[model samples]
Target: MAIDFGTCFTTAAVRVEQAGTAASGVVVTAVEIENSRYLPSLVCLDDDGRLLTGRAAVQLAAQRPERAESHPKRALLRQSAVLLDGGEVATAELAAAVLARAADEARAQRGGTEPVRTVLTHPADWSPGDLDRLVEAARLAGLDAPELLPEPVAAARFHAAEVQAEGDGPIAVYDLGGGTVDTAVLRREGSGFRAVAVAGDPDFGGRDLDQALFELLRDRALDLDPEPWQRLWGDRTPASAHQRSQLARELTLAKESLSSTGTVYLAVPGYPEPFVVQGGEYRAAVTPALTASIVLLERTVARAGLTPAELGAVVLCGAASRTPPVADLVAARLGRIPDLAADPKAAVALGALTDPPAPAGVDTGADAGEEAAQDAVSADGSRRWTVAHYPDEVDPELWF
Candidate 1:
């Protein structure tokens, strides 16, 4: 089983062998949690000091915003602990809540059997300390020594596996998740791929774009009726908090709808009617950030000692990458249409199930440590690699 613990959502996938067939090849499939492909990466501190995850966390958060930490991954990067509703909660504990939920669901799918192997995908720019926390979280989640794979490398593997071609030169991956945008350049080395360079902006992502739209709605609501808008913003009651949460969720849906339609209606709390936001207007508001992401991609490629034209392929990962403006900006800046996975959010988890590329200068033959390094897997055939152990020297400042 592989888990992609994202900032906005968590996704899991498992590799299973086909039944009743001579070939019986292994196939990777996404694991559905709570009847959804993407589980919201939310955690809430309940009255008893226990952590609630997924829908429970979301529901509790709506009623008590002070007790929730909506972005645990981001919080983990900034501090070891977060104070929620006056209670100090370890960041790793918050992360463990989400991973535990994923691991439980994946195990339930297999009739209570534990997964033979577990792999977790994370941002390529994560530092050794970040990774240690992640591993600790996994252990806390009941996963013993799970393997770690870089998000961009897993994304690149998905692209290569989907197209059945490695192509020439390095493959550039542009991962725009909910809270961050990560860019990486990877080149094939023997049977596996190696990271050439990585770059990202932890402050910019789909959430920022959502804020842009939120501000647009705020401006419109204030113009329509300043009193109600002011009340919504000023009220500290639970009802007001729930209403604000609902409004934020609606706006997110509206933003996603704008991708397929020309306009979307947003019902702001304390407002009498929904407001209309034109797709073009939202696109215009987010264009600058989108372009900045493209610039980062270019910079990462350059850092890898290559140009956009030299890239064999440019792959887009994360649900935010589905935004129409993202593809347009990427193509306009990179001079090529980036490849979009069938399910961007699940790409990393699914890709982690594929065979990892061999490390450079390692013999793939059965020679103990040499074979393990070559296959990038454990002796038990489960894939295992870590950015801390990656051959290339990573810039510490890039860690988020």
Candidate 2:
């Protein structure tokens, strides 16, 4: 099982092994929420202990804002304790629920057959402790701890393999995600990807644009619904929050519309006129934030000791990678337009399962009898499920 636990989405793919060495690797990818295009990356355990995921969870959070908590990412950053109905659910546990949902999906695709090997993708800047918690959560959810990998590193490895297979050269990976935009210079290095320089932002993503769009909507919505607008200002209550939710959905629609179209014909419940906000105004308001992200990303590559002239094509993924201005942003920074090879949404998961773990213990020259019974080989030429204990090499305090 190879899983990509993204900020707003999660995906998993399984590998089925075959006998013939050449035909051994087969990749199959699946996602948790098939009904909805977007995975909310949300988990809500209702009063009945029923779990909700994806759009259902997000929808519930919006309806019953008091009982439900959404956007665990912010809480994870604040290190704030959550008081759930049954007990306190740690931020890691919330993330774990989301991840476990992906694992559950993987199991369903494989007909309940347990996966022996697994890999997990995480944000590049996440601390080792953060990685540990993710692994720990997976374990608690009944899956084995996986090989933890930075998302860009995984993407680079995936792209590098494709280029090398086709006899191609250096490439750049422009990973514009919902939460961040990461770009890496993927060059062939030692039969793998050498990320020469990588750049991204911890903040600044489609969500940033959403906020700007909300502000613009507020400017429009107030004129249309001056009564509700006045009611919201007098007090910060559930009614006000509900009104905000209704208004914000319009902004969200507008922001999403900008992905493929220049203008959004938006209608809010309070707003009488179905107004249109041209993409130009939207672009101008969000350029500063996007520019800052692009500059940071470009800086990472520039610092890695390479000029744009020496590079290859750029590859990108993440939910927001599909935005129209994202490629333009990369081109302006790198001075060369890039060739997009993979679907930004599904490519990472597809690539995740391409590489398989060589189960240790197979002896090429072993007798047929010995080979028949052998599972994996250890470095010492023996395999009895050996576990090599390396020094902890990590601070235990951080996990607490």
Candidate 3:
């Protein structure tokens, strides 16, 4: 099982293999929550002390403004506890709640609590402390000591297979997710790849683009009436918080639509009027952040001892990669068209399952904590049957 615990969304996939069949390889299928593959990583606490996850947690965000932890992955970096339902909860615990939801989904999808090798993915540059915290969270969520895989490595592995990518030159992975941008260069090393260099800007991501869109609406609203705009767009007041959630939902939809269309209409919740955001305006809003991501990408490749011309492919991963500005920048900067063959959202999880960083032995129906049969192998000869705890979350538009 591979859990892509994204800041804005979460997804889980399992590799199923038949016994004694090396030719069958392994089949990777997404685990569903409420019949949908991805689950919103939002978490909240109820008045009764119950922890709610995914859609349930998001649904409670408006009703209990202070209790909702929107991006627990970001919180992990701060190593802080967020206020939730009138109390403080540690970030790792919050992450555990999300993982527990994935674990439950895994059990239901696999049909038992069978002992399975677990793999978890994290940002390529996450400190050992952050990685340790996630491991603890997985243990808290009732899973074994999971091997950790880096996001870019996982994405590169997944894309390499899709394109049948080959060469001594490294593959550059540009991962623009909801909360961060992680760029890494990995070259094939025997059966797997090794990370050569990595760089990222944790402060920027798709969320920044969404905020730019939100700010545009807010600026227009302020022009209409500052007093009312301040009431809903400023501070932590309940009404303001609720309006923020509402506007985030609105802009998320608009942003996704803007990816394919020339314009998007946003219905402002706190203001009397709706706004039409042209494609140009949206692109302008995100250009700075996307430019920063590109700069980081350049630095990453330079550090990896290669020029953009030397890269085999510039692979795109994460939901934000689909944004036209980002995709366009990658193509222009690298002079190689960005590969989008895999679903940007699902690529990391697929790669996590395909080419985990560690040599996690296969679990051929092993008992929990006990060894079983030989490892399962993909038809392409990569080791298989590793379960992972990668991060995932819904794209903002999917929350509502």
TM-score for all predictions?
A: 0.89, 0.79, 0.85
Worst 10 residues of 1 by lDDT: 391-400
Score residue 365 of candidate 2 by CA lDDT: 42
Candidate 2, 10-107: lDDT as tens digits: 66767777658876756455554576324666677676766577666766655555544465554455464576554677776777677777777777
Error of 2 at 31 (Å): 3.1
Clash counts for the predictions, in order: 3, 5, 22
Better of 2 and 3 by TM-score: 3
**Winner on lDDT (2 vs 3):** 3
Candidate 2: the clashing residue pairs are 172-314, 360-376, 360-377, 361-376, 361-377
Best by lDDT: 1
lDDT of each: 0.82, 0.60, 0.73
Which stretches of candidate 2 lie above 4 Å from their native place? 20-25, 36-38, 49-51, 83-87, 161-167, 223-226, 230-250, 356-400
For candidate 3, lDDT tens digit of each residue in 234-309?
A: 6677766777787788788888888899988777655566777899988988887788788888887887778999
Residue 178 alpha-carbon offset, candidate 3, angstroms: 1.3
- Give the CA lDDT, 0 to 100, for residue 26 in model 1: 82
Off by over 4 Å in 3: 20-23, 165-169, 234-243, 355-400
Clash count (model 1, backbone only): 3
Better of 1 and 3 by TM-score: 1
Model 1 TM-score, 2 decimals: 0.89
